[model samples]
Target chain A: MSETGVIHDIGYQRYTGPRLGRGAGIGALYVHGLRAAFGLGRSAKAKIFPWLVASVALLVAVIVAAIKSQFSEFTFSYVDLDDQLSWMIIFFVAILAPTLVSRDLRSNTLPLYFSRPLRAADYVAAKFLAMVTAVWLLLGVPQFIMFLGAAFTTKTGFKGVWHEIQDLVPAWGYSLLWALLFTSIGLLIASLTGKQAFAAGGIVAVFLMTTPVVAVLAQLPSTTANHLAGLTSPITLINGVGSWALDGSIGFDIGRYGPIYAIEAFCLIVACLLLLLARYRKVSAL
Target chain B: MNIIATQALTKTYGGGVTALSDLTVQVEAGVIGLVGANGAGKSTFIKIMLGLIAPSSGSVRVFDIDPVTETDKVRARVGYMPENDCLPPDVSAAEFVTHLGRISGLPRTAARERASETLRHVGLYEERYRQIGGYSTGMKQRVKLAQALVHDPDLLLLDEPTNGLDPAGRDAMLALIHRIGAEFGISVVVCSHLLGEVERICDSLIAIQGGRLLRADRISSMTTASDVLAVEVSDGADELAVRLTEMGLAVTRDHRMLLVPMDSDDAYDRILRAVTELELHLHRLDQRRHRVAELFTAKETVDV
Candidate 1:
């Protein structure tokens, strides 16, 4: 600019400063990756999660009171045996993951991820794992305390949380196991679409909305419905936890110790792998 | 040798919307400009090279590595500043860069040191400790660039780095890009649609339209340099140009000026003789050089 402030920058030069090497660069990117991934997750929690989690918690609290009332002796069907908490988890996954992942992709904020040393798979892993931790903190902690209390009160075989874990190893393990499954599934669905609403709604429609109708419609006199309330295969662990909490015996129909855990593990792993592959495809396209 | 190369890298999304197609190009060193109109596939081609998007049926390589097969490795060598303002609004620039430096495998002390140096380089040292949410557009842009460079990549890919900046900010950013290539020894791919701006900085330029490579050449070489001269006259301009043309000098009339392609002292003397004979008052006579702006007209014929 001249003295009068009439700007003239014709001889301008670009930056030529030294930077990090490749090996060290990737490490820098990881730092960027974690902050970015967790930052988005935290923002989502602040914006959207309160309503879903609080509403569900309120419903569960009401049910807790209702069940302790005159309905104590009444026996509902196996379908009503659980309070659709698994479905609630599924709902949260469907809505939350898409809003978090897909919307960013659709709007072409991809450079936000790629510019750092962050890998596509690492981004996927961070998002998926963070979701798992989030669900565990929000859902598992509350449900786990209630489980230990219920187990001790019933005096079936355990005394406290520690005793309950030893006596009812099947319950807590399955609870965390389901948390992993739902988190992975949510991320997988979100990875495919570019819009949050579409991904979340698609998850709801496929696993929760249509899967249940299909299972129910598929049920017949000689034919048994495979899933109850479309509990994402991993949700059986929640059923396992609910079963142990209400009753003293934690083991189930599959076997004395082997519930549908292998199925849950298998699904969770497959979901994670699939999401990674999809993330790779997306990254390559960028 | 070209550090980044693309062979007809095409991308057609669902519903037949083509983001990029047949975009064959090459980039060697220095500050290269990628200029196009909005939705003109500058981002698409960059994404392909970054391995962030897969071309429909083509390929891209960066630093002797297939961006697809060696994405992690490729990303290691490439730093990117996106077009959009997308920092996590709550994080400090220093915090963000240090985190990325760690991810790029920097030791704790080095990451912190590198973050400070980068923020300083981008002139954001005062605001580096502040959250990005409160930063002005230019400060935010510097933070974006700081993260890209904190890792010390070999190439920097900046998408519309000057977007939303006032004149001063754009000039500062452009100067930084040039310096990165020349002083930092880092090749840069700076994307912009403003020909006047990129022409001033980029050593080379590539124009894209309708997902296709429209043109690629050095900004210094694209115009196929002619011996054209810009001549302005204070009086009798029209008569002077006519006299020069009649004198067998290829004189062309341009707005408020005349273009004379004189080759020898004799040819120059002939034009001077014509001007003197016509009694025209000459204001200035300057050589015309090749510039990216000169070929913007050619960019119109291709699809975006």
Candidate 2:
């Protein structure tokens, strides 16, 4: 007999419930189901997602509108629509998955897990993976459409497929990388403050508000826009990625994409370490 | 050997608030009561044992595993229930418990099965499948308990499991705890501010105050109490025990009152004579036995 049954004497044979086809426990599946139904439910989705979709959609429309107008010979094609939606998908996913990571902490659901047999690092890892998977599904489906669209529209269908494969690697890789980074950063903020909004805001503030603000300030006057300064933040790293794909290099003349990847990797490692530290400090004190 | 032992465990929050202080306790393999006033360090002690917080100046071990250095192994042996209300309303009891079990390293099927059975034990059968947000407070507490027990630990740390319940709910919860500790053989560390509640269920008790150990002893070993005694005396409290013992009388202290057994009625004069010689203050010498509550309440006042 398992120790849990003997200790609890609940008496139903352990694991006698409805089974999960996958090797993972029904517990994880149950959590995923609850998240899909309520976490990504009617009330919250409309409020958070439309804005995400709209912003990404607008950016894509502008780029498409500009290209169509600038070069008269370039035909208006369905592949462009695919690319636009794909970007929107990735953008929404990058922002949304980390949003819930902070929410769980603010809600006090974390202590429940800690009181059980799980370790602090395990808890952080589970949450991290859960959030990463959410973003992957949200973005991966839409982005794959570009591959299919190119086959239907362009004369060089194989070339379109090649481009899709090339972009696919980066898009998927970045999604996971960004998910880990965001989750780590968001979790660090969440650990610092129990409030969900504050943690979420910290992520946006670092990525959207602070980095650009500093970059723009550097561009102004006797610019502190120094290379050392520009390379200091999460947003700056994202900016470098944006620059790499768009122009085959960053405007800052930063040495290749290697430095950017290295910076992101460093941030992710630190974020994970911080998460474990916070969990231990909190658990030890609980 | 002690399964859990602490040496002067103390915790001070950042704002100069001391949650626990100098609380030294040893818990073995049975039901043990951790009785104290609210804000008395029960939660603090539990947290420190699980390595949730560092003590200001103390050490702790849960199952011989230092909570800090061997936290994972230590946690594996402990099933903990917090006092506060903390359940995700959207998730069902079974789902919440299953997730916790999986996180504890149980296989998926095992996690789900345990979730089902544990919820049933806590009296949340089919309802375990329903959303927790829709359940009542009593139901919610059951979910909290289920999650704690999902891992099948050796020792269960229950921090006021009946904190906000009504009388019936409290009784039901207490009965379940007794079964877990005595019948199922799980060592229970139950903490509560209510002395009466702990006295009724615990075989041994460790009382704490301001983070210090006030007392620790088996309920029977600690107190000097005798069986039913009936004595008619002018002033006979301490002598009553002697007179009864000589004539084989059951004398016991139930607070300020001293009881002499009716079987020792033949030595009533001796009881009276000894009482006068000792110059002891006599309240009432009754045949009726006194409950543990009166004893603890009186002792608590005297200690304070």
Candidate 3:
């Protein structure tokens, strides 16, 4: 035996166990992306913004509930939950969409992801779903807390709770729609650049710039062109969808536009989805 | 069986620069070194084999599964350590490696278990919890390597694994790579432009130049000893060479050694007698073996 070439057993064990396939791989990315969206499993500084926004949003809900409990004759309900917190939702997503998607691209870690047992479509779907779920939680938690508060504090107690449940169900449904709408547009814009600040700024600009333009256009005698212009802003579309999904009404008088505005909003949603898919598809190749 | 095989693989980018052209090769299961200089198409070939990119006109197979068509299957069975730094700086090595292990289809508990084991094997156990942004370059490379091994894939494609390491770090990494292949029996293809390190660590070699296959063979065959014997003397190598030449032996003088053609049965006796007559102390004597640098010119004479 040669003294120099004797190989030492370094405990490099071969894995002979069961290995999951593509579905499990995609699930792992989904879970990892979900944690990243809220800045979990990262630096302490990374955890600050998302948690702060969540706390502030929840505090607002608590304060609102506290104020509502004072007046027994108050008829305030949960249907307007999204309206009160839409700006907060916008801010949360502006910070979060880039946190989930742009960091991977900016660090050029897509190749690390794509080189695994994951497909390009699966990766995009995982990121999109994570962002949607994040936005849902960001919006849903406060709504849920407020729902419990309103249910128990009412004068009629369980009866008021039963009545509030009826309204809360559709409000929950509207919040989900809000999640899908905001995440789709936010992730689509965030995927355009690898720079996180740029992606965040761009998302904020897209939301901030178009709202006034939509408001100005919606005032032009409620014309067909004006109603169509309302779909240009993602927030207006979210509001239109929320009103339609919750109260069966359309914002910016879009109902007179004969489903054209809704169709355009749906088309815009589809376009954002397709753009996100295409962008990650290109990244997977890199 | 060949773990990876490519048939006339070619790739051309948008700017009409050909990264690889007419490349055909087969790699067996062992520590195979890809020896080449920069821009020699080593990375392109690796990316193609990993199913990360498609060839312009050819096919590739990893363990007889086509990488282009069966990417998930191929990638599931293969681990890749890329040439570039591709780590998220905010995450610790433990979290990153475990997440990648799960992404490669290991169950969560097994992923975590294997992550620690792999990180320990890569000598990063002590600092696995530190954020990668604060890690030194060597630590970051080990993190990248740890992630690749966390899944325990059948094959590992390491592109420039020693790209930015100091000499000691490079030595430790090469030793770890050597042990991984020797002890665990996982096949490794270590891509490097340094001939000496590759020669030290790899069992087989594939040399390419200008995106073309220059030579592929067992490291032993490529480095077989030549017919010349190198003789080193303590005091006077020049005097030994002159005396050996005067004694009708074909000898040439190198810096501190004399090269003599060992042809006849009495060659050793003749050289010994000449050195004895000169009363010179012999330092060393051995047959001259070919080095990997000889492959550059050896290909011109031998058909690969």
Candidate 4:
């Protein structure tokens, strides 16, 4: 402004165009969350951890397939693949869940999210779905590689390939279940704190630390006590349920305790989802 | 039409802390500054207006819709820049601002296009691709502003946007905000405890104290000039004051200046004559304008 108070024209055009509504807002958030989970649209360094874990899983599957192809007489199936790669899934969840939940909280960015045309439930739902998708990719892609590898290396020709393809039906179901369950529990834990180290460490402690304790507890003489002990580690609970569902011999003996493990796993999943909802509800209220 | 209106809006948090108490005011579309001291409920008022928090009682209407009930509607047309650092470190300014635009309901292509335009307008075109963690404080502030603008909101709720900038950066940010209001015609409600900058850029002000509305009026009315002219001389200010008094002009000494009542026909001429007669170097002679600080003090005493 000059001494005479004449305002100059600095061009800042008003937006007179069409603006999208609430559904588009929710959809955008879902896309952004999924991108952030895999470190897409971020720095190259930010992409390292997720890609490294994914690469390691892929490499293991390839190496396993190579060894199986070389030794044509050895027996292998997708159930055995899931058993062998269970720890990798646990590790993937521990490291990646924090990226989806903790970073936003740590930066106090909830106001930014809430200030948009989105409800708290929408924010939580989008994040949860993105997390499930990320975990599914991590766990499912390797199993897909294993399926393809198994079909090609089969000496029994089309019969062997058909059998392997049939086995993938159960494999994909189990992989999706693992994704849903781990996403719920991991996101619930990660939502508790903004500190990534603490969230990640806590997730690791819950998944890894409970394994040995559950093992010792399962050695009890009583059958009921052994079935109850399987409820401690998510890995064990999932394994127990898988054994019951598939009637396979991978981890625990189903015997009469199969239904008990399945019920406990279902309850745990529901509890984790409920806890996640409650945590986000409190944050939005504030 | 009023851009925002509150009817007996109050917010009382847990443990009996009242952040806002019965703040009822109407704000029109323009550069409106929300000024108050720290912990004076400025943030609380903003959150309620944005529908980020519910009021304990009463109602808030943004763009003529109840924020509590139609929060999504209100938020769809409003963009908010919070008082703290909220950008994720791992993302670049381009990505973060584009993501915010998407979150605000822009399509992917529109978000990307607007993100670049907004970043350029905020003078961050050169560093748009740099990670935000590497940005300076001024750059970070610009990034925050850019995100708020990327959505092309009808109104902007800026909570202490200039909190951490140096004088130069503060000047640039205030200028950008001023243009946003004046040129773009976006209704801006800038929350700041810094009264000077608010006074400089805002057309009207909503001043608060102790969780209550102190006053809301045009900046011109609040800062109307008093009937006094200040005279500053390089030397002999006391002599000048005495000489002015002798010349039948009521004068008072203030630091190195003489405050003469402009009750006469020629206040400026009288001061110039006195300075010329005394042969003292006249540094300045200007009318004593009322400031926002004086307005605040005046309102505080009036409330008492």
Candidate 5:
């Protein structure tokens, strides 16, 4: 053995690089939340539920595209696709909203996050934006498939594809409305609990349980109540807004209450978002 | 420069329970220990330092930045390991720490590199890729520490870093903390209820009781040698104690050893002469110093 062996200095090194500010923190959180919603960078078990719903949505889009190509007279527009897949969208939100918000609560990781440069508003905003984008992709991607199906079959050249683009853009907006409303409400419900099961169940219950109230309210022997009953449920509320603003009706009539539906949709989204921000103003004591 | 300074910091919840009452202290950069019992506002003090919760009244500054107004600026330079299970079970330690590093403002590649380096520094090398749920309490604590260090903050606020560890694990953790402070040149404030652990690793001590500052001083000053000599004999300790009392010195027997009060400069000579006259084999003789635990019990006795 050598008598003069030297000891290497492997001490902790200080990072002298540029440290980004709050914007970078929020952006990283947004990226992480979005990946988590789709179970990216997680175990195979985590990917099962998200991909199950996503695959089903993709399968339906393929079937719709095939059907539209086969039947030249088929009038199933891109907006109609979102209307038909509303239940899938609800299921997607139930699965996704909890994964985005409740996991942090369940694991009690908010303190670790808050102890950094990220603020509560930044946290809430990143999560909300992530869920919105996830839901929009779930709906918007399928609508694009339907457009592709129509555009390929059209013999009317570029103008036909341009027409398809026009229809697809409005349908994407309609899907965005669905994304915004469902995400805000679902995230608000999910944020209230740390247990993912309870949050998922509560979110599904809120969305499913309200549709019956709209049905019952529409039957009150008053035309005014029937026109205003869509406000009672988020599902019908979106349909009412779609029918009034996008001129896409899916068996729901808002009558002259188009502006009311628009205002209620807008107000409901704003209120849910505000409530989420308030809920996160202080993380759980743990 | 003082890393943390607080003046009349009071935090009263809505239920009228005061967590911190008029706490005023300034801590310099070193391995400082914050020692207190459960519910003694140690956690509350740390949270206020991190700006996690606002103080009900008064002012608090971390790194000379007001935590309440410039929370982000304060938090940017402070790494905190909370006193709870904050690790997500499903993710590996490497991924989780890297993610937190990114949130703490490191770019993507730097976060990954720092996460690996930190995990290795915390004595977690091959196990960094394993899921944290399968880790032992010691390994989990290492993961938590790794995340806190991955950001390379100027100061560290660790709350009960060795809370659920065995004796050997505790020793390893204390050694790591000591190295982190002494070698890494980063200031640390270790909040713990165990005074022995704090005294073993800290340069200064801050003791709190019932949301009040009991004492704040350097460990050296707090543990200065008391006017007592601890002597151990191979045998005949009882006779030695009796012989010491026969002289002017007061002696107290503690099991096999005798504690003699050093009242004069000749105390050691008197002890040596007593041992020689009694023909007892002197095994060990040393000055008895104050322990950090004495501060708490001493205050209790004064209160009574």
Candidate 6:
């Protein structure tokens, strides 16, 4: 028992390495959100809905590829695959959007997030990018499968393969458009509520409830209303834009209102993103 | 240098509800306790320090950087554990903490290594792989703490670190916090309503009430010994009290004990002489010291 005291080193090391800045914070959040969207790095129970939707999507892509390879008369194009899987895309958005933003809101982890080197714009950007990437991969991967099916079945030489690549590139861009529009709208709706169930339900309702409005407006006996009807619902609006820009790939008639559809789509994405940023400016503490 | 400084900081919410008003305080390094009752603006103050919310007026700085303008620079060096339940139930603690570490600007491998180290430091190494939903309140609190410390921050803002824990859990958390501040050489701002816990681990105390600063001083200064002695007798307490009063001492009886003012140098000797003269059993004899709780009670009596 000496008078001198001993302060042992218990091996608590300090981090003196290079700490990344706002870019890294946003990148990490994007990666985390993307993984969480597909229920990666989560529990088995948490993986059920996402995997269920994904497996069905993959199954449809496989069947479409098989049917196209078997019969040359099968008229399913790469872009048409998106149109065919639009319902699955909607379901995927409903499941994925809440997992991206609503879980953070429900768990009240925004304070922990914002307490780091992350700003509100960075958070919204990272999450928006993550959802867009997730949705794009959901459509893009399957479209690539369809491309492979068509590429393998082509009797012509490199020209046919080159033609398939052109169609596949535009279709990938179209899927990106779907990802952008659906993710913005889905995230905006999901960001409003902390309950994932309510968020998922509200997203589906907003997307579903507007289709009837488009139908009623389309049957108004006026050609202008019929041509402009797709602008009412997000699904038809995307289809309208795709048909207009992608050279009538989707048969929905936009008539002379093609530019209007494009303008509306751009404005809708920007508006939703702005609203999402505003919603995160002041997060409610639990 | 002061780790945090605020000058006339005020935050007035919409509908005329003020959360903080003119809160001017400078906090140096060490384990500082922010003690206040509910709705006493403790959380509001911490939020302003973390730059989570903008102050309506006045200016604040952390590490010489204004949090409003240089929030990222300030936040890069500070770690925050919010008061509420912020853990997602679906993810394991290790994954969640490592993700948060990356968000705090650590590299991928460094984040993972530090997450494990901090979890171990908080005594949560074995259970780090379990999902947070199955964790007890104490274990969840440690997970929150691990996330805050994963980046090896210079400052830690812990809002109620021992909140919702059993007695043993509380003592363990307090000891962990003490070790973090004393051994790891990190400045900590622990926001708690329990004054006793604050007094036990805090080097300095800042008590706020109604969004105003009540007192800010060292814990030793705040709880100095008072000029009074407490004596408990197993028997003949009343006779000792009477004898002490007859001998020109102000004695007050409280239950089976007597409180006597130590105004003279021989006060202890005089009390002992009286106890011996009365043949009373000397059960206990000690000096009374002031506690942090007295500040609130003293304020209440003045307001009344």
Candidates ranked, most accurate by lDDT first: 5, 6, 4, 3, 1, 2
Candidate 3 vs candidate 6, lDDT winner: 6
DockQ of each: 0.22, 0.22, 0.72, 0.63, 0.67, 0.62
The alpha-carbon lDDT assigned to residue B20 of candidate 3 equals 89
| Collision pairs in model 3 | none
What lDDT is reached at residue A266 by model 5? 95
lDDT (CA) per prediction: 0.67, 0.64, 0.83, 0.84, 0.89, 0.89
Who is ahead in DockQ, 4 or 6?
4
Q: What is the TM-score of chain B in candidate 5?
A: 0.91
Score candidate 3 by lDDT. 0.83
lDDT by residue (B153-181, candidate 2, tens digit) is 78888998888899999998888888778
Question: Highest DockQ, which number?
Answer: 3
In model 3, the runs with Cα more than 4 Å from the true position are A1-10, A72-75, A154-159, A248-252, B227-229, B233-235, B246-250, B261-276, B281-288, B301-304
**Chain A (candidate 4) TM-score to true chain A:** 0.89
For B1-304, candidate 3 gives per-residue lDDT tens digits of: 9998889989998899898899899888999999888999998898898888899998889999999998888998888998898998888889889999898889999999999999988998669988888999999888888888888988889999998999999998999899889987889999999988888888899988889888888887776654577888898787887788888888887788888887776788888888888998988777765567776577656764
* RMSD of each candidate relative to the true structure: 8.1, 8.1, 3.8, 3.9, 2.6, 3.4
- In terms of lDDT, the poorest run of 10 residues in model 3 chain A is A249-258
lDDT of 2 by residue, A81-177 (tens): 4333543443454445444454455556767666654556555555556655654444454444533444445455678668657766666555555
TM-score (0 to 1) for chain A, all models?
0.61, 0.63, 0.89, 0.89, 0.95, 0.94
- What TM-score does chain B get in every candidate? 0.87, 0.78, 0.89, 0.94, 0.91, 0.89
Q: After superposition, how far is residue B163 of candidate 4 from its true place, in Å?
A: 0.9
Which candidate would rank higher by DockQ, 2 or 3? 3
Better of 2 and 4 by DockQ: 4
Q: Model 5 chain B, poorest ten-residue lDDT window?
A: B219-228
Across B71-107, the per-residue lDDT of candidate 5 in tens digits comes to 8898889999988999999999999999999999899
TM-score, candidate 3, is 0.91
Fnat per candidate:
0.42, 0.32, 0.76, 0.70, 0.75, 0.78
Give all TM-scores, in the order shown.
0.66, 0.71, 0.91, 0.93, 0.94, 0.92
Model 4: C-alpha RMSD to truth? 3.9
Worst 10 residues of 5 chain A by lDDT: A277-286
